[model samples]
Target: MPREVMIHPLAPAGEPIPLVLVAHGSRDPRAQASTRALARGVAAARPGLDVRSAFLELAEPTPAQVLSALRAGGAPAPIVVPVLLTRAYHGRVDLPAQVAGFDCAIADTLGTVSEPLLAGLVRRLREACPEYDAVVLAAAGTSVASGRATVAGVAAELGRRLGVPCEVAYASAGGPGGADAVAALRAAGARRVAAAAYFLAPGRLYDTVMSDALQAGAVGAAAPLGAARELVRLVLAAADAAAPQLALTAA
Candidate 1:
């Protein structure tokens, strides 16, 4: 039996552009699943648009492979949107190297601090536990100075939003780890400390933060920003911003 193609009512009249969302791959299957789920959400929101997910490594369909396939399929003007949370090494160096010869435009990495992201954090924190005296923003740390700065800025912004002091902690590579941060809060007489997952997916880093922080006296740890509607909107917004870049590339 032939299936009828159902067009989305809100779909644009003309051919929609393809969006290649490239995520930092993980060894944990949940990371890949969450990445795909986020892409699915974006595709659902903008029905006619071609939204695809690819990884950096430790996963199938690397970004290069996806881009090559898109080029071979005669995609005239596709764009690559990094599913990364910050403009760190991956976004600054690796992604460009991957799409070097490809004609597709690359959108900006999702910034550290945004209204939608803040709301997502609040939602996750509330779901994890009740109001706490302190919060720690747990991130996958990087040696890059700018990357650390980005996380710090986000922690500050989150603190403002929650009207509570929020400290930045690292899961790998850099400074005060989740356990350390939580312990500091506990030592300072904080009866209840919550750690917010300043990450995109569930993986080794996130798991470490949750487990270690709780062991170090944190009351709870929020879930990763997986498949959040706000994240989907951010991805789509990134793609739209790059639409004009296609014209510039053609020129």
Candidate 2:
């Protein structure tokens, strides 16, 4: 028997269960690369699993478009794994609205702040700079209490686990933005401040925020959390959570 490779959404055959990796796309090359790398990592973790990637906005393969493409290709069911860290516009409103009538499973956002994720974050922090006069656990920021709580909890836990003084800062929410991370640390009497980027990808927002902030005397900007091995597991867990235990076919 001969097997064929299905790349396009038009390709048909078997009820392939598509694990759609959904990310908030950015113009930054790093962000784009991170999304692709994460998708690859997920597929690697689940060898036989049919995994794919899409963007929430500012990129290609929107939810509806990807779902339509997959459905057209005759996939049995597709699960949407939001690569978002917070339940902001994309996770809370945009994603739901986009996939309202779609024939697929919508998994929770990838911001579960799992133990492995926290561990990985801590490890990255350690690697970024040895001395954290004051560690500012930063995030994209959100108005939703639940969303803020999730990231904040992670930061608090990380601080406790790592045994350091950690505080939450936002880069996009306009409150205590990343641009102020260094300033806050300096004000707090930090000798060498480190901005622990609580982000998944790098982009204009991240670059500008960190660049201007670092110039203000912060030691260094820790890399964004993306495509790490633990990240793959987190996304898969989300997919499994969204999937029905009974495995229903697309109607």
Candidate 3:
């Protein structure tokens, strides 16, 4: 867990602080584009607020670059929001190291189980498969045990919400892949099984998982949470919780 930083609701007496979203960058251009789209959504949702996107690796505009530009522009210490779904290596180690020298407060990860995030998953799943007896929540795998536990929690909550059995699967790293999960659900006598993408953006991993799920008899696979309204709200909420006084009202 990250150390809590005390922020007085009335201390910052100036313009709204900038929000820098730091993502675990990918080599795929689609992933980068999706991150930029989310940043635009944040800025559009809150006019006059400075919203920027940075990457931990494999993409342009690293955290250091963004923070340096902000410092040069005389902007106050900003909140660095990690656009990560789980508190894995990237959130717990990589992100902290990347933004270590910056005079900025780090907010919590988007997390595995949040109301807005769950809703986004459901919305995407429904759009992909209107009817399914079972679902598979496919995530970009993490080696951290705690991170895997959180993914399971999210799967349980999603199952409860959708009134269907949901299992957690991984696209890489360790754990059951999408095909295995789908096959397991079928073996348990499920007629239709669909996959709900637990990714913030589209990339090769996502494509591979969806393909495997479909090949394993999944009905359909939902798209990633790219610029979804629910996701935009979640980002704003994270920013608000980090800096109360500079919280941008969600649209």
Candidate 4:
């Protein structure tokens, strides 16, 4: 995709600062489609907000490029909300670097997991399978200690929510892949194990874990959390959290 600003069609005169949703770009075409769908959902949920989407890498309209365009267009400073589920590489490293010299309000990443997010996961899991001995929350997996910790935290929360033993597994770049985790659950006497994809969209990692988990004895694996209304609300909240910062920037 070309580097361009996606302004909302209903943007009013002297609109508040724009909301830029920064997603970890993917090479897969479906990834872009998912991201755009998510942006559209956000825009629909809050028609008065000027919501736009950008990529951190492997896609166009990067954070830096978006900032440049916003500045050139005489737009007010934007509130950048990372569409990441964790505060790992993209959130901690790439985002800061991209907006380092720019004037924008940067919100924290969505987090390892949250209630709204878990709702989406649970919805997917229920749709995939009705019965399961154990649940595995499978993330993309990051080598960063903080990222791993976030995943673990989310797993713990998910365990509480489901009232089941939830294990944290990685799809890549980490240890204990989904297949292995599910297998361990089975070895521990679980007859049915289901894997819940922690990914935001369908991509290589999502596909890998979905295949591995199912092949490794998992009865079923939930689909990725793509453009779900729960996620749309979460993204809007992230952008809203940066409102104070946006006000400061405009001042």
lDDT of candidate 3 at residue 194, scale 0 to 100: 96
User: What TM-score does each of the candidates earn?
Assistant: 0.92, 0.86, 0.92, 0.91
Q: Per-residue CA lDDT of candidate 1, range 1-251, in tens?
A: 12213332221225567889999999999999999999888888876668899998899799889988877886666789999988889999998998888888899888667887888888888899877989999998889888888888988999898887788888888568888998887777778899998899999988886787888888889999899887876787777777788777666
- What ranking of all candidate models by TM-score puts the best one first? 1, 3, 4, 2
Clashing residue pairs in candidate 3 (N, C-alpha, C atoms within 3 angstroms): none
**Candidate 4: Cα lDDT at 32:** 79
lDDT of each: 0.83, 0.74, 0.86, 0.81
Minimum summed lDDT over a 10-residue window in model 1 is located at 1-10
Q: Which candidate number would show the highest lDDT if scored against the true structure? A: 3
Give, for candidate 3, the lowest lDDT window spanning 10 residues.
1-10
User: Cα deviation of 2 in candidate 3 (Å)?
Assistant: 31
What residue runs in model 4 are displaced by over 4 Å at the alpha carbon?
A: 1-14
How good is model 2 by TM-score? 0.86
Model 4 clash pairs are: none
Pairwise TM-score winner, candidates 1 and 4: 1
Off by over 4 Å in 3: 1-13, 244-251
